[model samples]
Target: MDVSKVRKDFHILEKRVRGKPIIYFDSACMALKPKQVIDAVNSYYNDFTACHGRSVHYFSAQTTEKYIEAHRKVERFIGAKENEVVFTKNCTEAINLVANGLKWEKGDRVITTKMEHNSNLIPWMKLAKERGVVHDYVEVDNEGKLDIEDLNAKLETKTKLVSLVYTSNVTGATLNASEVAKICHDAGAMLLLDGAQAVPHMKVDVKKTGVDFLAFSGHKMLGPSGTGALYGRLDLLKGMNQFIVGGETVKNTMLSSWEAEDSPAKFEAGLQDYAGMLGFGAAADYLMRLGMEEVHSYEKKLARKLYDGLKAIPQVTNIYGPSNPEERSALASFTLKGMNPQEVALILDESANIFVRSGMHCCHLYHQDVIHEMHGTIRPSLYIYNTDEELDKFFDALRNIAALA
Candidate 1:
């Protein structure tokens, strides 16, 4: 994949910390933006800093054109129709669109997994609390792999939806979306995939998976923040209710009566992030040019290197993820014996200029209920721009920390 050349595209990689070269290993939280994405966002503010789809002036027209083009680019990126894509502030909002938009009757059931991030879990729990809807979770094995039998057992005729994470943010274990989708559909339930971790690291085709809805953020994929999308089947979206109201979301409004726009526009309300959308489209284009399959292959190679390196260290204990590199994403989460996760993370940053995530990673329920780790695990996430030398440095830092313990 010529990672050295790829590294040149990101300006943030050149940054230094405490007079030493910075080693970034926290792509799961937010990926570093490339110059192409930065330029695309800058051009929007520089040339056409105007409201989209609200005026007929030159700036507005240009902004509107780019905005619609961004939708088209994302549609192509995820193998969805243009009308099916709805832009949201982030992935959390995208998921909430489906959560709040759907009509939930009392006793209606929704199924999820323990491995989901808080963004995916909290909304459904809110539904259960405020409304009369029921929410259930599928079980995962010790390796953080979902139990298909438990998922099947949870599905019932009253099951309204099965929402799950495509990849675990903490453990890096990936779900078989197609299989899960089939199970949900067979039981007369719709499937929604939280693709925040999966979309950035792998090729995801919602059509191939037959999922009713998909949500992901652009910030985790080398794009700007406040940019994300929701892809829903046209038929399903047409039947759902609008989440937010006012502005472009409505077709016509009389004193007390209003008609909402169709599909995508019906969901998007108020002024959108025009600049962020352009950057998101550019980020998708960058990944497409490089090829998603190639990106996935390269990341898996690096993940295996990191996993094996961590395993070799005697102080490293309770490594949490799939043992097989092919079954996991480009990250690993583990805990060092006799050291707090936060302390280890601080040491790595202070001594080696390394950046990583430490904590439950917003999966507190999973950490307490499933893994049973109170403090949490040290997570080192990777991307295409990362190199082998960086992994070597990470291992060296860990070894030094281990000696002190």
Candidate 2:
């Protein structure tokens, strides 16, 4: 998709550290901003410089109009209706909003996987603690793939929901959403997907996937931080109770009581992130222009090179997730023999000016259960801005480091 030309859109790519140009492989944790998104964020402060909703001045009017338009932009990007989207602080908040919106009973059950990020795992754990709700975790195999047959056996009539990761941040594994959705529906349970990792790199349609709810962070998808969204079914949202409520969430209020607004507004309580939403919409538009199919194809090619390249190194050991590029995202986690992950990451940056992530990648349960290492593995995740030349540099640097080990 003309990635060489696309690289110019990111000004940070030009920065040099020590003597070498920055080779960013940390897109999984947070993607770098493009100039287009940066400009959109600046437009609010530069052009409007006012609050959204309840204000009728020129700047306020412009802000409200653009703010609503941002929702439409994000909605269209995910194939959702006008008001089906709820803005939040991050994917953690988005998942929490969904988790709290539902009615929890003593025996109500939620089935999730062991490989989930803390954002997905912790909320359900909280539910189990506060309420008498039962949360069951489906196990992953040695390769980090969830056992589908085991998941099917676990589903029951009492299971209220099934939450799963669309793609693992540490393992680089992408689950079969359609298959998971079908089992939950057959068991009379709803499905929620943690889409923080998948939404940025691939095409995801809420209606097509049949998932009732999807949570994702804007920062992971080239948008500003403190911006995220929840895409929920209209029927489900209407039935579900709003978790957070405050300013502009209601039509009327009295000392006696207050009636909340419907759907999105009811879910969104306080003043929103106006500039971040504009940037988030801009990020979605940028990806739309690039076309997700092209992004997916390019990443698959990159993943193959990343997986195979890591495997060829003599001292490299224990690559996480599936070796098949088709079964995973454009990220890999591996530990060097006799070397710690943090030291490995530090050496790469110091010696080669490479930026990579180390540590559990926020999946502690996965580490305790599957890979069996709390120290985690060196991870280099790719995005559209990454180039083949950069990967070659990474591989050469890694080979040198492995020789030292």
Question: CA lDDT of each candidate?
Answer: 0.92, 0.90
- Runs of candidate 2 exceeding 4 Å displacement: none
Instruction: Compose the digit string of candidate 2's lDDT tens values, residues 1-405.
Output: 999888999999999889668999999898999999999999999999788887899999999999899899999989998899988889999999988999888999999988899999999999999998899988778888889889889998899999999899988888878888888899899999999999999999998889999999999999998889999999988988879888978989999889989878898888888999999999999999999999999999899888888888978898888966678778999999988999999999999889999998898888877778878889999999997788899999998888887
Give Cα distance to truth, residue 250, candidate 1, Å: 0.8
Query: How far in Å is the alpha carbon of 166 misplaced in model 1?
Result: 0.4
- lDDT of model 1 at position 145: 88
TM-score of each: 0.99, 0.98
lDDT tens readout by residue for model 1, 1-405: 889889999988888778889999999999999999999999999998999888999999999999999998888888998699999988999999999999899999999888889999999999999998999988988888889999889999999999988898988988888998998899999999999999998899989889999999999999898889999999999999998898999989999989989978899899888899999999999999999999999998998899889999999998998988678777988999999999999999999999999999999998989899999999999998998999999999999998888
Kindly report which residue pairs in candidate 2 clash with one another: none
Off by over 4 Å in 1: none
